[model samples]
Target chain A: MSLQRPNEKLKSDVLIGVGLRHQHFTEALTTPSNIDFVEVHSENFFAQGGATQSVLAQASEKYAISLHSTAMGLGSAQGVPSQYLQKLKQLASTCNPILMSDHACFSWSQLNGQQVHAGDLLPLAYSEQTLMVLAHNIDRVQQSLGRSLLVENLSAYIQYSHACMPETEFLVRLAELTGCKLLVDLNNIIVTANNINAAQPLDYAQQWLAEIPTTMVGEIHLAGFTEVKEGELIIDDHSQAVSSQGWQLYRSALERFGKIPTLVEWDNNLPSWHTLVAEADKARMIAEQVFGDNHSSKVTTAMTGLESEFIHE
Target chain B: MNNNDAKKHSLQAAFEQVAQQQQTLISAIFPSADSEVIDEFDPRGMAIYRNNLLATAQQALAISFPTVLTLIGEGLFNYASRELLISSPPKHGDWALWGDDFPSLLTNLAQLSDYPFVADIAQVDRLRQQSMRAKNSVIEQASLQLLATHDIDEIYIELTTSQFGLNSNYPVIEFWLSHQQRVVSDTAEELNQKFIQQSLDKLVQGDFSQKVLIYRPYYNAEIRELSASEYAWLTLIKQGVSIGKALDIMTNNNELEHDFDFAQWIGIALEQNLINHLKV
Candidate 1:
């Protein structure tokens, strides 16, 4: 397979992509399409061999691929494993994704004096100490990749009482320190808000979006959440269609972030390929509406901010 | 202290605090005999994370060992997976690399004592997964010329690393492949059931000892059964024995069929990608 360089250009116009799942590989590869890019879990293709690797190569040719990893453990005090980063570097060198991201969480830690991967994205405290660790690890990753990385806010089940700052402030500070950008998942904001029993989750999420500088967010993620009954936690399961509230948050995010590269991620109980693409189409149409109505102030400021050398190519 | 020194001191303090808390949480999740339960975390939140971890482990293992899950069902699989997770918890983040010890876990579990063949089936599944995830390598077709130019004693046959040999007393390939068939149609499901029944019958008859070869010539891993002679011959070839020495060893073995033909075996091995290259 050819190790061609991925398209690094971040479009100033509205761009939408779908998560290219293994089940939808044939349809995505064979069909005539208008989707701008495809995002895949980086760990799934780390093997770099077999049919999985072949399908990823085919997807890379068809669309601008995003390498979103789940296990980079960017906030772990133990730091990212050299072996894991080496494998990721090999995959990145081959696939050459346009964007790579992981959560502001830690999955690697020592248990009973033995290093272990928790196999789940464990939440990190939003403190100066954690920020230093996150920045140190992100710097290590960026230095290894010879490119910038994106750190995403997680939908955490538990919030640390000792956290010194808001999640948005923490992420913005992370970008400032590491020269990385943010993948602001709108669904995660809403899910986290609802889980924390925020009286108005949509309003909370909108405020959360307003805190980050427009240029710091390079990409936006729109996904669905599974809401439980009273006395249960709302899950960022990505099982259903993007909620109407999620769309509203997307609109709010667009009004602020202004036409960033967005992805519609439906991981569980996956819809058909056509149905999945429709979600991306919805995101594009919504972006057009958001930018069409408020083109002067939001668009211009976001454009001016993004045009600064840090966020733009 | 200087500004940079102060920042470094704070960072070290933070690392220690975060590391201590994380280790505490991890110990709670994968508790050992020496584990001390820290009461600082909320019980409800801890339960959510614990459930999520176990669920993730189950899903990951199910992908690697689908036949084992199918045979034992989810309830038992969850129990055994949880047991395995606490004992041999994934050293790395990749779940695919985490379950190499699952077959041994199955063999040692008292709950699965009645189904000993399940362990062997799991062994085959692990090898199949390894074969699928192994680095893709190309056969040195140029080295085939060595077989023709050199004498039998002077030439060594090399097999691809993707090839694995599993010798099971149970009918593993038959039992495993019967489940691998995609029963898309009702008729296919019936045929699969029939094949599974036949295999079970052979399994009960107690002479179904088989040697299984999982070979990956290209992308997908394929499982095939080998006769005693072919397996013995391949085993010798894998031990870096010369073609003549392997043949001589196979011929002298009373347990193996003396009718082992290197000419036919070479043709079959090359076609199946069992032979990587011929070395002199």
Candidate 2:
């Protein structure tokens, strides 16, 4: 299987991929076309030798594989675990992912001489001390992996009262300090905005787009979130179709960032492969409209096949 | 307070305050309307976190106890899970090790006490999960050949990789197997002493006592149920017993009922890769 390098340049138009789940492993291997990359959770493939690993290996040969992690726990007070880093290195050496990404939240905390599951991507107090800790963690991760890691912004439910800075500023400062890229998950920003009752969705998007270094935006994530009550949004629910608001945010993001690779995540209640492909087609249309033709040759080649058959005559 | 001391004091104060506000903070994390908090916005915000925590806890429990979840419907299982979470929340960040005490928890629940075998089902479910994720030492090919020469009767043997032990008075395995055939309709009240006695009678006469080795050699979890004769044989092998004495014990006890074939049983064990090594 061909492993895409972390530093490899992406095509101009957003290349769309789905979060590959075990249920869809067979479908992913057999079905082809229009998907620019395939992303899988790193922990799922931690098994030594299994059907899951075999399927991932097969898919990697055909498509660009991006390894997204949930266990890195970059913001942990105790710091990153060396064992996890070693396992990640082994996985990277085996899979050769395009970009390795983890959430900006901590999953572990010290308890009774053992680290216990915090059960949530916990929100951290944005202070100078936290900034330093986060920078050190990111630096260590990059140094250990021998490549720059992309830290995705988190979808928070509540804001810390003592937080001295906004999340956007924290992310920008983080990127500047570590020389790492940012993975702008548009759904998370919307969820954060709703939770805090802070800014309008478009205003938040515009501010983030203008402030963040566009060059450092390595990828984008588009997912569906369900609203359980007023002013509360659950990001990545995967229950319904992508909301119009999310698509609008994607369009605005495309106009601002200019055609980075995008991903459509359907983790729960995953529909048929064709259903996801259809969503990818929508993203392709948006990409074409925003970036135009003169982007990357690979994307152009992919587009030509998809456009003539799936999009236009 | 001095500058450094003041900073430390304030941080400590902040953390204490946050911890003291557990209800509010937990509500923010899990958000259930059923909480004692009176504020409308508190419940709304709290419900989001409540649902999130519940859903995540439920997912962890489901992964750890797939067979248990299969036996009980998702709704009842989820309802039972809430009680378990309240009693014992996850202490670690890894969800894989979350539901360790669920079987015991189920056994103690007053609501589920009627379903006497629910806990045993949970035990099997937990073992299945452990078998899938637990680490095991790999055995070499040469180790199998050396076993034949050793005096198996003189030594005690231990299962290197596959280790699933169960000791119960109730016929839990049989009940589990029966439930798989169809949905269980008997309520706790309906499950009388007479039925229990009848089942126990069947169990003793029909070779109810058994030992099984559960482990993951390649990828998936495997369960190999052992008969009384085979159990004795493996136990002798495990004790570092010489093959001759082990067979002698088996012969003296008349453990093997009619048509006893040692070669066939050994072949099955070899094919299953159960024999790890011989202890000299």
Candidate 3:
């Protein structure tokens, strides 16, 4: 079955949003901001009741909610847990999120006959078998949610020897098979390239982005990476500001894919709400520069239902 | 081989290889059986992922067991969390659901032998965390009419799903309350020592046992101390016992200093949202 997009209207504008961390929840709900939407880690709000749901409800009242999960582990051979899907469905029903997404890595595997979560995104080999697993899980999730899922590419630290295809080709095929869209995380591409010692990581990422069909791409994610000592890996820790290289890569993305709803994801060493918003504003300015004035002006229509409800409340 | 059969064999081989590789990589991350699981991948990259898993597990435990962290200090807490993560990695993707084994780990630690109250406090933290995540309850006031209309022997009082009870030998409820502020910075050793001394002093002077009731009456979980008789009464009610039978158990027990007052206890339980409803 073909998965339907969560919102058709979202495709019209160059919308920019920020990952809504808990520190900025009060300000995000209480104050008006320039952002078009707010993306939250779906697992963070998984609790059945109490403050999490209440906070999510208040946040939904103010802005469009994007449910980005880290642990769906769509590439896992063991399959997504039924309880996890149930909780996610309940959360989606509660907020009616504008977008739902998860990483394209496997975090669930069996150890000693017991299924366990690695607690971090573990890289998957680019093979037909892995692709099939991802497609099956994605189809199941889409069927459960009755919408398309946006699968983000992982910044894999290690490479498998027996991979059958390039990451881009694998992702494209995944989208084709499952009718799911891809959440192209630009920084993850650069991080992966740089870790493998690509001569020009930025150019490599642009080349990577060139492979995916533009229509299959749903959203863009811009994040900063942590630079370790020389000879050490540059981790996708999302701690600092987006690098000069990252922006250039993002520019290439906008040039190639046109304006897509983008998110500024700074998950660690979190800055103030103002700083986070400034990062989103920077993304918006870049998108404006790429798509010109009319596209940025169209972003005002992104939060369709919440704006009036927010004002009335 | 035929074309379709050849494709099927190739796909099966690929699936087996991928599954085997993931199992090796995950086992290496937690380092249980094989130390040389990094032969296929870059050792440096594998180490980074391994460290990430430990940090993730540690951070999750810190959030759920803030009181334990504050009481034990950051150094010890991190070490314990890392050890637990290595021994039994998170089975649940959500960290909140993964740390139920943590209090038991605290109980089993040899280093914490001197601080006997630590395990009980950890249990309290776990219960509070569980209570917070418990489904929202609407106390069924309409069902209370069953208590008045039906014979006491036929009536059963149901407690909210969020309610839990813990009976500890040490005065853990007091210790848990005293260490509510979660220390983000490295907890000073001297502070832990001082707290330990105070806890030991309180342990010597305070009652030998404390019955703690943790329940989310509204949005937040509240910890309330229960008398022995009250704890016994609630334990009976929670066991699907009829209200008359529970009262009989409390009344027949000679350990109590005073008589069990069903009316007074019901009033308090209703007020505190401990009772979901009285059913017949």
Candidate 4:
């Protein structure tokens, strides 16, 4: 059977947002609703009761909320632990998020019978065995939430030789089995492609894109990556602005995906709010250039912040 | 186990090998502890996972126990936290509760002996964090009525889950009180200078013994010194003692030893919301 696809939710235009950051909490609340939605990590609001929940409520008030998670180890061999799942479910019900997403990697594993949290997303082997486990876990999460989830790919530094299938193929099979959506993170694809020396990386990206049905991809993630001192590995640290190679790849993704909801995620070395808003505007402008013919009038109406009355000086 | 169980067990076993033991996963793409690099991938690739684990543990400890970090300097703190990371990795995905046993790290390190109270401060840090984030129980209507109707000998009293007490040989409460600013933003060197300028040694100089009472003060943990009878009564109640025996010791009405103002004591307990309420 073919991969199940959800109906398009947002208007085909207005395709970009910046992840809501506590550093930019003041600005996020005050800044005009230029972006479509603000994504917050679901685990941050797991407290019994605290100010962080109120901050999230305020952010939700201004823009649509996307509960992006980092800790739910969906690819775990044992399974997603029930406690983390319960917390995420509560957050989902509370926020009524527009979209929820997490990495297609394991961050928790069972040592004997005890569940241990890795706290960072660990890559999985791209084999059918691994795929089966991941598919089962993803289905569990989606069923429990009563909503579809968009699982992103891992920017793995190492690959497993036993991974008989390619990463793209694994994801395609996972989506077909679980009815899950994909949040294709371009920078991760770029980072992994470069690190793997995939001959022609862009063609490889296009090749992977070709293998997966575009309808299954619900969102796009653009983030900055840093290369280590030895230059052998490009770490997806999400520290800086999106690189030129990353931006070019985004254009390719936009050309193929056709203006899906995109997010600019900068977690470390956080820039000022103005700088982040500019990055969101850049993504919007790029998408406008790609889909300008059908979406020009909508783009004019979406003029916000610097793109509007403030600066053209 | 079935085939699915076998495959799942194997996956978890391999994941634990890397995550818990810091050993490389035995994948051809990763080095097998020995430097056998694959054809295209670099051997250093596995270092990324190791580095990610380190950064994650380090950052979690940084937020949960900022007081420890501030007291011991960043370099030493990071070093100690890394050691603690390997020894006691996170049990749950909640980073807020990740460093639950970090105080033991401070108490065990020999280099930190000069500041014996630092471990207590770490505990204070944890309790403060828990108190601030967790909603405290309100005074239970049933509990108050039950307490009012029943004589001290007729009922058993218990402290709320939010109340904690530490009887330390050192004046830890004063030391903890001196450093309880909610946020620990100062560098260790700066904090050390402040510690010296305030002659903080005096806090620990007295009989060098004290009892510290910890309970929810509004949303955060409030650290205060306990009176002789308050401390005795709480200890007895905490041990599940019947109120009669505790009262005998508290007021010496049965000539047990001493005397306390029972009416004033109950009023204070009611005001502080320290008495446990019925669970249902």
What DockQ would you assign to candidate 3? 0.65
RMSD of 3: 5.8
At residue A185, what lDDT does model 4 achieve?
93
- The parts of candidate 1 lying over 4 Å away from their true place are A1-12, A293-313, B1-10, B31-39, B181-208, B252-255
Over the stretch A203-239, how does candidate 3's per-residue lDDT look in tens digits?
7988899898878888999999888787888889999
Top model number, lDDT = 1
lDDT of 4 by residue, A1-313 (tens): 1112233323336457788878899888986645777889888888866567778878777777788999887887657788888989988778778888998987665433445677777788786667767887898888888878899988988776667888888898898999888999988888788888888877777777777787888889989977666467888899999876667778778788775789999999999987887787677777776777445323433456534322221
Write down the C-alpha DockQ for each prediction.
Answer: 0.70, 0.23, 0.65, 0.33
* Lowest-sum lDDT 10-residue window in model 1 chain A: A294-303
Candidate 4 positional error at B228, Å: 3.5
lDDT of 3 by residue, B1-280 (tens): 9998997787677557667778888888875534455456898898888889878878888888989998899999988987787567788789888788888888888889888778888898889888888878777879988876999999998888888999898877667766764453445445555666766776787457779999886888889888888888888998999999888878888897465688998888777778877788
**Model 3 collision count:** 0
Candidates 3 and 4 compared: the better one by DockQ is 3
lDDT computed for candidate 3:
0.82
C-alpha RMSD in Å of predicted model 1 compared with the true structure: 5.9
Per-candidate TM-scores read: 0.90, 0.78, 0.89, 0.80
Write the candidate numbers in order of decreasing DockQ.
1, 3, 4, 2
Residues B174-202, candidate 2: write the lDDT tens digits: 55544443344566324544445655675
Interface RMSD of each: 1.3, 5.0, 1.5, 5.0
Task: Evaluate all candidate structures by whole-model CA lDDT and list the values in order.
Answer: 0.83, 0.68, 0.82, 0.72
Query: Model 4's DockQ?
Result: 0.33
Model 4: clashing residue pairs? Answer: none
Comparing 1 and 2 on lDDT, the stronger one:
1
